[model samples]
Target: MDNNILILSEGMQTSIQDLGRKGYRAYGVPIAGAMDKYSAILANKLLNNDEKLPVMEMTYTGPKILFEDATLLVITGADMSPKINDKPIKMNVLYEVKTSDVLSFGKLKSGARTYLGVKGGFLTEKKLDSYSFYEGITSQSRVNKGDRLRIENYEAGMELYSSKIKVKRSHFEAKKLEVTKGPEFHRLTKKHREYLFSKQFKIGSLNDRMGCQLKNKFPPIKDQEIITSSTIPGTVQLTPSGKLIIMMRDCPTTGGYPRILQLTDMAINQLAQKKENDMFKFDLESSFDFLGRLVFRFKD
Candidate 1:
């Protein structure tokens, strides 16, 4: 009846993340869900848990786990060579872990982040009706070494399930991330704006929950002054240092940087699929691309 997952060892940082709160970014509340949101959904869906359930968000690596009792679990996003008791378990599939059978994760093999989910949700302090926002939240971290995740027993004795879902290689090979022209699209120089939508830019390394910086050719922004108004996750702000910062899951609500272009929801999801140094180009448009972006949709 009682099945709680205990953390035995951690990698760099891992924390409990749900789907994150909505309608709060206006108040500077970032939607702090799993970095790879689709991966989390896959984990949750594999275990029949609600999409909003708190799952372990593991970045780069994951923690060793000890189950208080038998439990069901799944993992998705990024290849971290996750194994159970020295035996590798296929990712994107449901699996069983007996009590004392440790679950461990190794260094990142393909992607940057991964999600580990159990049949029941992770027991963590829920603020604003969610257990996300680890950076601002002082007490918890995205799964680290020596952490514990309390869960409940969903399946009784002799429950064994195993299957692997191999995400198509093309999904990982995507190179283009489309975006809508920013609200201040008209503010940019005619030439600079034109060059932006057509030219391809490399996704930089200065990226995290906060945002992502795209490399620029000595950017078009020469000044540093601007009126701070509203912003969202898709906002692309240009800093004085000539870096284009694309806001992500945990971005600030307002900033003085010159807003360049805003990624559409589809593009944002596509952005999550991007690897370091991935070169991408976005087309400029007068309106948002509302439909026909199925590939960019984050799916389980």
Candidate 2:
């Protein structure tokens, strides 16, 4: 595994991410992981790697990489029009890249983030028992140009595996996100509650790994704040300024804003693929309803 990839250009925001460091939220640490868990898992699975192995989480733009050795790579999530040695290649399929092969991306066609998984996963220093990068935790928050990432067993015999496997792209297109009542869901006035469900929200341009700031056309809430309490990814808090913030995988472990709605695990995954300016509605469901849908989706 002495082979390494030299980063020629760091895209908008590229970072090594895994399933995130869990069980550290009590210490006010955020779970900084891949924004799109489904895509990360798919990329890893295609390489027969661990389901939670670290992958490159490329946002908006993708990095330019020069492989020092021939290795298998799988691209999932957003279609960034990847190319090997300047030859256009399709995504969601494993392809062998020869030594000195240059990999890069073109304009984004769909989705916001893309997952790049190497043959044996990208080797990086871990913090809090996880490889996911965080600003204050990991030594490096994001990959930069000229950085070298060691690839495990890059020169070893390539394992024989499926030549190409296609994952349905339609699963990433979601317009409605399912949510459940949060702790303060009942505290809102009747009109406010109705407005929350009936109105549409647009993903603000300021959205990032911390959370997705939503723009609402309605009036601002009357400065109703709550005592700082525990929060986690998917916690929907309504700011006094009338904006809605859907916490993401990198959001802080707690907050003081009023928690109005909480997105389900599936909803969070679906929302992660949405880019700025995308519009989506929140559909509230009961606990039983949520579990029922979850079961049916994964029954196989």
Top candidate (TM-score): 2
lDDT digits (tens) for residues 118-143 of candidate 2: 98898888889899999999888999
TM-score of each: 0.86, 0.93
lDDT of residue 92 for candidate 2 = 82
> Which ranges of candidate 1 are over 4 A from the true structure?
136-138, 157-164, 221-224, 273-275, 283-288, 291-300
Clashes of 1: 9
Q: Candidate 1 on 48-142: residue-level lDDT in tens?
A: 77888988876666778887777788888777999989898777988777778888887667767788888777767777778884566536555
Clash list (residue pairs), candidate 1: 10-144, 10-145, 13-142, 14-141, 14-142, 14-143, 15-141, 15-142, 15-143
Off by over 4 Å in 2: 155-157, 163-165, 218-223, 292-300
Local distance difference test scores for all models: 0.73, 0.87
Deviation of model 2 at 229, angstroms: 0.8
- Candidate 1's TM-score: 0.86
lDDT of 2: 0.87
Q: Against the true structure, whose lDDT is highest? A: 2
